[model samples]
Target: MPLITLQNVDYSIGGPLLLDNVELSIEPGERIALIGRNGAGKSTLLKLLSGDLRPDDGEVRVEGGVRVSRLEQEVPHGAEGDVFDVVAAGMGELGTWLAEYHHLSHAEHVDTDKLAAVQARIEAANGWSADQRVVETLTRLDLDGEQDFTGLSGGMKRRVLLARALVSAPDVLLLDEPTNHLDIEAIDWLEGFLKAWPGALVFITHDRRFLRALATRIVEIDRGQVTSWPGDWANYERRREERLNAEAQENARFDKLLAQEEVWIRQGIKARRVRDEGRVRRLKAMRVERAQRREQQGNVRMAVALGESSGKKVVEAREVSFDYGGKPMLKALDVTIMRGDRIGLIGPNGSGKTTLIKVLLGELAPTSGEVRLGTNLQVAYFDQYRATLREDWNALENVAEGRDFVEINGKRKHAIGYLQDFLFTPERARAPITRLSGGERNRLLLAKLFAQPSNLLVMDEPTNDLDVETLELLEELLGEYEGTLLLVSHDRDFLDNVVTSTLVMEGDGRVGEYVGGYSDWLRQAGPGQVIAGGGRGAAGVRNAAGVAQDTSSTASGGTGNAAAAAPQATAATAGNASAAPKRKLSYKDARELELLPARIEQLEATLEALAGEMNEPAFYQRDAAAIAAHGSRLGETQQALDAAYARWAELDG
Candidate 1:
């Protein structure tokens, strides 16, 4: 049976429909991703699912004994309660009844009628074992630790809320933007937890990585309509692009036919003294048959204009050290930025990407050395705090600053006309800045920023509030941009799509540069690379040797290249091969450590494949009998891979 169902649900505020005849259902153990542009009624749909808001029409039904838990973004943490206590609230209803039953049964003076009633209620609720269930649920959520939950950061607080929701063991769980504040580590942890979750899940999130990792099906909401696609986010994206392209072609064909028909009607009607009945009838039919063309194009493309390149050395840091509030964040860091460079700054949160940006921008003075900006470097910085715009100003005034002489289409244009290019309608242009949604605000800011010419662009989390269309636009612009760029973002899609070099920060202000995407950095950071370096011997080297070695290992592609860099082998001055007998590896030990990295890579490939399969609805239904068959293999593969990695770590230790 479906865990929850909604039929012909409609919601309206002041006669404007927010939700129009929307219907959806959730089944047991299903993981669904809900996606839509901002203000497309995603939050409203969640509210309806959780029973917080009743539909204006139609029915919402739940299977017998089904319960639901929803985490609302606006829901305050409620007075003075610690994190664990809040998660414990999910069991509040059950706990209350249990406590009441206990008190009544053990009361000093129990009335006969009350005693009978309490006993009956306790039997109905199975109240005797509620505490055990609550304790188990809390532990699963990782919230039962003795650490102070109230003092946890924003991401930690979100985890607590998730735990609280899970504590009830609800039949269906509704999550809204669950990963909005999470770092990469926390997201990976959440992904693991969700893989093992047995309940139905309906989550709304903009994190592409998280969606790809967890979602089994994609549900798109638009203009009061909801459609389900059979695949994960990536597949859904492909299908959407294909459909849009087809629609555009069909529309073009119709437009050409309509133009031909209009020309015939014009010539025919003018030649005849009066309109012919058949021609008029044909023209009317054509007019009636033609579909109304959608006036608004629902895409915001960022086109960044890169100014003329400056001489080399766009930005330079010399023995830079920085301390914030007397705590050292960076120590004697030296780096250089050159013209036309696309550099990505990455590190764990709180490692001071923002501080470094400030130092480069001359907003913060380094404690020791200095940061120098190249001569005539025009910088356009996208600050993370988007709310800095004046809330009272209209959108056009905010973007165009009342510029009436701006050249557009080879003629001077007004602020309203310029704003229209950014997708703000005439009515929307007059709307107050505060009335715009988060994505809208970000778009306005991007429009304003891109309109100005700059030699260097420094963007921090540029993808945060952008929709898919806007993000792709920015990606294209950044790719074509000839100016220098410094970016700080956790969005892997954005990083991989736009960046050429990575600047990673380690603890104690140490910085390292890796020349590829985040995945490349992860592979390099793995145990094999670390152990293989620093002149280790046969124990450290894997089977892949000679020409089979990865290019990333050495600057040159020669066997002598690897040996020349080895500090140990340079000691030929001391002895030949006969002087030191090579150690022999036992077959058992060799087998144990030999295939560890290969096994790990194989498991990663399998996991990615399984994730891709789960994203496909057609695959899930068409191969229902094979679900467990594939799932079990995946599980076994993962376990073996994990064991191999752990064993290798122990041996290497």
Candidate 2:
């Protein structure tokens, strides 16, 4: 039996159909990733699964006695409670029993039997350590247990809500954008937690790393229909591309056939004839089928035009330091930002990333030192708070404020036309900013920021609330960008895909630059080492005698090229090795190796056929559960093929 099932579900708001005839069945221990474009009903589907909303048609069913928990994007408003209390709320019945025991124990006449029953219930629920678990969850999410929830920052509140959802250890967990406000450490922790969770999990997240690490299956909602693929984000992307291509080919074939039928119908045989009337009916049916197939092939378009370039040295900071209330936020930091440098700023939350950006932009003066900007440096900043937008103004007004027109490629384009380039229709352009979804607002902000031609771009948490499509589009645009970029984002995949180097901000106000992506930074930092003011000594510097040398510096001010300046060992330091002769494979092993390539080729062909079948609109529109089973078989075949290749390589080597 499935843990949760949705059969022919239809959901709508106002008039437009958000979900139509969607069928899904989540089995036990399945990790499902729900993904779609913004406002495509991914969250609405999650809500339906959690019973927060009922389907307008069909049925949503959960197995008897199963518990479902959901973590929504919005934090509960007007809840005047501490973080601990809120998180403990997830305990449900056990929490009620615990509270009742406390109340009864304080009564003048102690009810011994009632207390014993409550204690027994707690033991049965396995909630004896519930308090400790709540505390631990809160700590991992970076929320103080004693802090008032209402007073917490938006990010902190989000953490608290996540903690509440996780503390209960429910049978089914549904999370919507769980990593929206998390830092690198917290996101890593949450990834591990979700991976180890022993239950059915469904979540909506744009973080590619998270999706790759935790999702065993991918469910996409496109054009009011649901299609599921069995695998992580990387596999889903490859398969989706293949599916789209196959669909295009199928459409082309249909078009060709329909054109021939149209030609036959135009021959003008009398409709009164039986054969001629039958041909007309068949032609009409073909036209309907062609239209349906075309609707399944919708596409999203994105293009970004990078601005002009600046001087070689775009920004330079000389021994910069910042202090707030006698506590240092940034130590003596000497950094040179060259043109075409894509730098990713990283650290724990509240580690002075924003402060450094402010200092660079000269919005705030450092306690000591100076920042210099190179010639013709036009910097465009994307603040995480969207502070530049006015809530009362419409989207067009917000984007076009203070300008009748904006220049693009040395040509003046009207504000409405510029807005259309960002996918905002005339109707949406006239909508108030406050009514826009988080993603729409983010897109509007991007449109406004990118409208001006700037040689340098500085963005803070730019990936928040963006769909996977937008993230991919942004990554492509940034890769093609000719100018310099400085970005602060917790999305590790984004950092790896977009940035050339990473700047680590230690919580103690020290900063260090490493030449590589986030994974490279982790490799150099090693186990249990915080990224602080240190050299790449652990990255392995060797002396003339072949001994590892420490080329570290104690000073806070250090350039990014620390590893480049380290001395190389001489040829004499190279160690001699005994050359072992290669051994031939045994008869059985040789025979198996000979057959492996054939088996691999056969599996590849099978996978290709399965992909083609999955791409067919009829296959998806017919039975989603059967298609998912086929996907699973496809994944299994792929794994087997990989193992066979590995064995063949081992024997051949």
CA lDDT scores, all candidates in order: 0.66, 0.73
Candidate with maximal lDDT: 2
Task: Give the TM-score of each candidate.
Answer: 0.70, 0.74
Please estimate how well model 2 matches the true structure, expressed as its whole-model Cα lDDT.
0.73
User: Model 1, range 1-653, lDDT digits (tens) per residue?
Assistant: 78888899888764346677777888889899988776677888889888888989978898889999987653354612444456556677665555455456556887778777766776787865655665566677666433466676667778877877887778888998776555544555576678678999998876665666667888887666777887555467668778778978987898798788788667854566665788778777878777433322467634554555676888899999998788777778888888888888766456678888888778899999989988778788786666546777877777677665444324555666666666777888889887887667777777777666688998877776565666767877887788888988767556756777877665566666676544434423423232111232222222222212221111111111121122232233224544655556678877866876676667667655654453342543443235535545555554565565556555443
Pairs of residues clashing in candidate 2: none
Instruction: List the candidate 2 regions with Cα displacement exceeding 4 Å.
Output: 14-16, 91-144, 153-155, 259-275, 286-309, 402-405, 526-653
Location of the lowest summed lDDT over 10 successive residues in candidate 1? 551-560
Residue ranges of candidate 1 with Cα displaced over 4 Å: 10-23, 73-81, 89-152, 249-297, 305-308, 405-413, 526-653
Best by TM-score: 2
